[model samples]
Target: MSKVILITGTSTGFGKLMAITLANAGHNVIAGMRGVTAKNAEAAKELGALPNIEVAELDITSDNSVNEAISKTLTKYGKIDVLVNNAAVSGFGLLEAYSLDQIRNMFEVNFYGVLRTYNAVLPSMRANKNGLIINITSGASGHTLPFMIPYLASKFGVESITEGLQDELSQFGIENVSIQPGVYPTEMNNGSKSGIHADKPAIIDEYGDTATQQFNALGSALFSKMAEFKMDPQTIADGVLALVNMPKGERPLRYPLDAVAQGTDQEFIDARATIKAKWLAKYSN
Candidate 1:
C-alpha cells in the first residue's frame, strides 16, 4: 500500500535516493530541499519524473519554512503518514578552533532543524493519531571521533531528542525511530569541509603547525577509511523502506544501518562493562 511521505534534504545523498526510490514504489513523496533554487528545481524535476514525487522549498533552520512545508504537505496530501527528518549539516575542525557561532550554526541545522520539522509535522500526526518520524543520525552519535566534534555533538542531540520523543509519543500512536547510518560516500563528507574555519584560531603556537598537519592527515585517512566501508545509498534507502513498512508495534526504536558500527558499539559497551566491574570490585573490597 502506498503512503504519503515527506522527506527533507532531497537535493542530494540518502534523502534524494530515498525520495526517488519511494516515489518509484508508488508512494506519494513530497521531496523537500533547501531554498528550492534552480539546482534544486532541476533535481526535483529529475525525481518528480519518476512517479509520485513533489518538490517543495524547506529550510529546516527556519520555523516559517518548516511550517509552510508542513502546511503544503497537509494541503496537498491531507495527512502525513511518514516524516523523515534527514536534513543535516556536517561541522569539522577542533572544537576550540571554530567560533561559537560556527558551533551554534551546526546545531541549528542538525539539531534544531530536526526539531523544527518535527514540531511542524506533529500536530497533524497527533490529530490523526498515526504516523512515523524517522530521524537520520550517525554512528558518531554513539561513538566519538576526532576533529568532527560539532557534527558528533549535533548527532548526539538527535539521539537524545529521538529517544525522548519515542517515550513521550508512544501514547499518541506516533512511532519515532532514529536511524544511524555509518559513513557513506556522499556530498556530506565534502560538505563537512565547508564548515572548517578559514579564520580559525591558532592552536597552541609551539605545536600549531604540527597539530594542523596531523589534523589534515587524520582527516584524509578518515575519509579514505570511510570510502572503504561506505555502504550504497540504496541500501540505506531500503532500510528506510523497512522502517516505514514495519508494523507499528514491531518497529525498532533505533536502527543502526552499518554492520561495522554495530560491532564498534558492542566493543564500546563491553569495554564500559569491564571498567565498571573493575571499579566496583576495587571500591567494594
Candidate 2:
C-alpha cells in the first residue's frame, strides 16, 4: 500500500538514500531537514524534484519547526504512516574534551530530536491506531568506544527512548524499531565537528602525550574498520523497506545492519532477549 512517510535528516547519507528509495517504491516521503533554504538548498531542490518526495524544513531541535513540519505533512497527506527519525549530528572527542554546551547540542539533535518528532506524531497515530517509527541509531548505541563519547552517549539515550516506546506504544499499535547500522563511509565520519580538544589544548596537555596518542590510535583503528567493511547506505534503506513490508504487529523491535557481523549489537541484543524473556516470565506470570 502506498503510504505517506516522514523522514528526518534527509539532507544526506542514509536518510537521503531512504527518502529516494521509499519514494521510488511508491510511498509519499516527506524529507525533513535543516537549512533547506540555505546550506542544503541543492539537496532540498533535488529531492523535491522527485515524483513522490516532498522536501521541507525540520530542525529537530526546534519545537516550532517540528510541529509545523508535522502539521504540513498531516494537512497535505492527511496521514503519516511512518516516521523515520534518521536525522543525527555526531561529535567526536573524549568525554572531558567537549563542553557541556556542545554535548547538550549534540543531544538536542541526536536524542531530543527523536523526542520532538515522537511527540508530534503520537497523537495522530493514537487516533488512527496505526503507525511505525524507525529510529536510526548506531552500533555504538548501548556501549561506547574511544573518541566518540558525546555521540555514543546521545545514541544510548536514543536507544533507551526507542526501547521504551517499543513497549509503551504497543497498545496504540504503533511499532517503534531501531536500525543500528555499523560504521559506514558517511560524511559524518569526516570529523567535521571533531570537538572541544583544540579549544581545550591545556586539558589535552594535562592528559599527557600518551593518552592523546592512544586516542588517536583508537580513532585510526575505528576508521580502518570502516574502510575494511565499507558498508553501503542502501542496505539501511532496504532494512527500512523490510519494516514497511512487514505484516503489522510482527516486526522486530530492533534491526542491526552490522555489515561484517562484528556482533557488537547482535550480541547485546541476544543477551537482552534472554534477560527480557526471563523477566517477563517471572514478572508477568
Candidate 3:
C-alpha cells in the first residue's frame, strides 16, 4: 500500500519531517514548495536526493503553480491518494494594529493557499472515488486569541473547510481531517523563520507598553510550556503517518496533537462535536 502523496511547505518544519517520515515508510511523496530552483534549491536538492521523494516547484499562493504541480503529479502517478495541506504563514499582532493588506497577505498564504490546493486536487480525487486531505491547522483554531488573530483566523478557516468537506466528499469516499497542533519549537516559532508580524508602528505605539508586555508574557509562557511538554514537531509528522495508515473510514474529523493541552484540546474537540451534532440533528428534524 504505497500510496502517492503530495505535501506542501516541504522546505521546513512539519512538512519536511512528514515527507521524510512518509517516504521512509515507502510512500511516494511529492515535496511541494516555492522557488524550487532558486530560494529553496538546497532544500529541493536535499529532499530530491532522498528515495521516494520528489521535489516540485509549487507556490500555493498561485493558482497556476498549484495546478501545474498537481497536474504533473496526477499525470505521472495517475492519482494523488493523499494531500497534506501543511503550507501556511504565521502572523502576530493586535487585530486593529494590522493593516488590511497585511491581513490579506497572510490569508493569501494560509487561507487561499489551502483553497488552491483543494481545487487543484479534488477533481482527480473525486474521479478516483478515494482520497484523504490533512490540513495542519492550529490548536486555537476552535476559538480566538490575542496577538495571533489573523494567523489563527486563517487556520480556523481551514478547520471549517475540513469539516464541511468531510460530509460533502463522503459519497465519493474522500476524507478530510484537520490537525490542530499547539505551539512547537519549529523554525516558525523559534525566530529562524520570519513571520508576518504587525507592521503598524504608529498603532502599536498607541497601544503602548501594556500591549507589548502582554505579548511578551504570552510568548514566554508558550515557550515555557513547549519546553515543559517537550513538544516535538515529529509528533505531527507521526500523526500524519498514522492517519494515512488508518482504515479508510476510521479517521476522525479533527485530530488534536498538543501535549501541552493536557487533554483540554480533546475536551474542546469533543464538546464542540457534541454541540455540532445536536445542531445538525435539530436542522434535520
Instruction: Note the Cα lDDT for every prediction shown.
Output: 0.82, 0.86, 0.95
Q: Give residue 184's error in model 3 in angstroms.
A: 0.7
In lDDT terms, which candidate is top? Answer: 3
Cα error of candidate 2 at position 223, Å: 1.9
Ranking by TM-score: 3, 2, 1
- TM-score per candidate, chains pooled: 0.87, 0.94, 0.99
TM-score between candidate 2 and the true structure: 0.94
Give residue 96's error in model 3 in angstroms.
0.9
Give residue 226's error in model 1 in angstroms: 2.9
lDDT of 3 by residue, 107-197 (tens): 9999999999999999999999999999999999999989999999899999999999998999999999999999998889988888988
Candidate 2 global CA lDDT score: 0.86
Colliding residue pairs in candidate 3: none
Evaluated at residue 81, the lDDT of candidate 2 is 96
Note the residue pairs that clash in candidate 2.
Answer: none
Better of 1 and 2 by lDDT: 2
At residue 225, give the lDDT of candidate 2: 78
Q: Model 1: residues >4 Å from true position, as ranges?
A: 191-193, 196-201, 204-207, 266-285
Off by over 4 Å in 3: none
Candidate order, lDDT descending: 3, 2, 1
